[model samples]
Target: MSNARLPSFRFLIGFEAAARLGSYSRAAEELCISQSAVSHQIAQLEEQVGQPLFRRKGRGVELTVSGRLLLDSVGKSLDQIRSGLSRIETYMDDSLVTLVCPAPVVKGWLQPRVDRLLQEHPALCPIISIDETARYIDEMDVDIAITREPLKQRGVLEVPLLDDELVAVVRPDSDGQPAGMLCLETDLTSDRIGPFIREHFGNLRRLAIYDDPRLLLDAALRGHGVALLSRLLADEALRSGQLRHLAAYPSLPLGTLWISRTEGEPRLPLVRQVFDSLLAYSKG
Candidate 1:
């Protein structure tokens, strides 16, 4: 097809809308433009085709024979365009794998390894959903969920990601005092490390208690207090000399981190690829 012979798509769109609705005003309303603008575009389209596409009747318009033929062709073309666009959107959505996990896991684990995963699988997109409660995955639509909590849901594939150990961390220069205890008061911590804290730091005064590990980690980094944090979360800080590990306290075993997906749903190739990458990264 010759490029010069092609009609203005804008004009055709206006023409089709006006013709289909039998009212230029209604078309303008649907297109969010002035009624005069719709009329002007239709007039331009008619001029291009060398024939009137609409006949003014009362307050509305009627399609002429030429208009009817053009409307038929334009409608089909626009429908095809819409269908193709919809397919593209679905494909983009399919390329994304939604990962639901706690905020600490997102900050401590996934953020560090995400760039490498993306580099390896250029076609895959990972969407992170942070939920500390770990209850939303079963209630909401999620492709994969990582949680320290055991999955009670049936027909789900669960793979062990990491065995997180809890350790007391503080800023490099600090007086390890009882008043400098920064406690993370989450359900997971309460269940796993509560006894450990009582047994070890029973006389220690709590500087602050946080429900989120990320917040606890932040407080510890600022030299507010010594925080009992996941080894994974404090790893970077410890390695870089940003935070120092207190030698007096013993490390407490928290639990295993597990990545799970619904079993019945059709596992797309991209989802599998993302899961495998995450598994490998966590293991490493």
Candidate 2:
């Protein structure tokens, strides 16, 4: 066989991190390295593969087709490593709280306080996962779950998180009022758009929801139409004056956010740790 060796696992990990985050700077920050180091490692990886993996954008980079194919391999290997580490973790008894919440809840709200959690509980680590809306409470892959509606489970302790108003987000330079546009938001909706629209607004004539909020939100940002976005998602835009609420004073009545545990002393300590942290922030 030839003497040429494969790229190091470390290099693969760096590439995977860069590709997953879509920024070399973020990859460096996450991997705890300098941007130059990340770039060098990616260059080495590309040399090993005999092809360019990324193309430069204005200030960053985008993955080439070859890079996208490599991401699947790297992700699978990384996940396997994670699973092996978790399996080993079961032998040692340490406190770990897993929070299963909605996308915006994870990004907008919980993310801000994660550092504080680490400072308080040095030995405890929090695991967060994104769970869908189709009542996957008990079936969720995490120890604690945040749900919009009460989930049916035996001996599960539930605490209300908060209820925030929905707002509309559109491009700032857009010419028309948000009230006269089609709102695009919500993914994996459990209800029909026609009735849901009428339930929230008396006139269901103008609004419709698509499959993914990320897509619709992007469209809204491009001056398309009003998106019925959660306060969690639209808070930044509202604060920056990039968008406005369609209502005179916050018309939508969004329900409560609930944090639930799997019952009894087995999961109580972990549940209490998260509950105490979130209770201070919850309005409900």
Candidate 3:
């Protein structure tokens, strides 16, 4: 259509809302504008079309014959525009992935491997957050969650990520004295190594109790005391000889890490790609 012949897009939108709703006041509310604004736009649209679109009836308004025809066309065009915009939104979301996991996992494992994953999948964008309070996985607005608790919800996909041993760890340069033990005050303690630590190292002074694994790991790294740390969390430190595992103490099962998501939700390609990369990295 020529520029002069084309109606104002804004006017058309106002007309569509007013016609579909049959109330200029209602349309104004929907469009977050004043009723007079909707009226003015509809007036401009009628002037452009050379015919009245709406006729004032008793206490309300109704579309005229010409208004009805224009409404039909305008509605369909708006619907198509909305559909196109929705598709674009979905496409944008495909490049973004939101991940939630424990603070320890983020600091110790995922953070270290994220650069590699991003490098391999250049289009991937990750938003990582920590949730150590054991919140329900499905309650959060996250694409993927690495949780310690088993998700029993139906239509949720859960993958076994890691099952590592918890061992007493300390800085290599320390005197190796068992002054105290840094402990994580998490469910992992009650489920896996809590009893073992209590029974074996009960007499030793308690160094600190932390809600986050990163804090406990930090205390151990600083040579404050021995810490019962997951093999996965201490992997890099042990490998580089920054921390030493006490051979005298036997390791306990640390518990399995499960990566999960709502199965019914459409999986974005980037989400799947990142999920697979995380699984592989965890296994390593």
Full-model lDDT for every candidate: 0.79, 0.69, 0.81
| 1-284: candidate 2 lDDT, tens digit per residue | 13678789889988999888888999999999999999999999998888788898877788999998888888998999998787557524456666788877666566766787777767777767785543343423456777887776777777777785556556767655445445554422435543455565544245555666555555666666666666766655565676665664234657788877766553436556766767665542
| Tens-digit lDDT track of model 1 for 1-284 | 23447789888888888888899999999999999999899887777778887898999999999889888989999999999786556545766777888777787778878889889989877768785454334423466888887686787778788888888888888864635688777633665567788888767778798877788889988988778898878767887888988878898887898888766443567776777788988767
* Model 3 lDDT at residue 193: 63
Error of 3 at 237 (Å): 2.5
Q: Judged by TM-score, which candidate is best? A: 1
* TM-score of each candidate structure, all chains considered together: 0.62, 0.52, 0.61
Q: Sorted by lDDT, highest first, which candidate order results?
A: 3, 1, 2
State which candidate has the highest lDDT.
3
Regions of candidate 2 where Cα sits further than 4 Å from its true position:
1-95, 119-124, 132-141, 171-182, 185-209, 221-223, 239-242, 264-271
Task: Supply every candidate's count of residue pairs whose N, Cα or C atoms clash at under 3 angstroms.
Answer: 0, 0, 0
lDDT (10s digit) by residue, model 3, range 1-284: 23558898999999998888889999999999999999999898888888888999875689999999998899999999999786557546767777888776677777878889999899988878885454344423567888876777677789899886888888987784688888888733585566788777787788688887777888888888988898878877887788999988888876788988767544676777787888888767
Q: Give the residue spans of candidate 3 off by over 4 A.
A: 1-91, 132-140, 185-194, 262-266
> For model 3, what is the error of residue 113's alpha carbon versus the real structure, in angstroms, after optimal superposition?
0.5
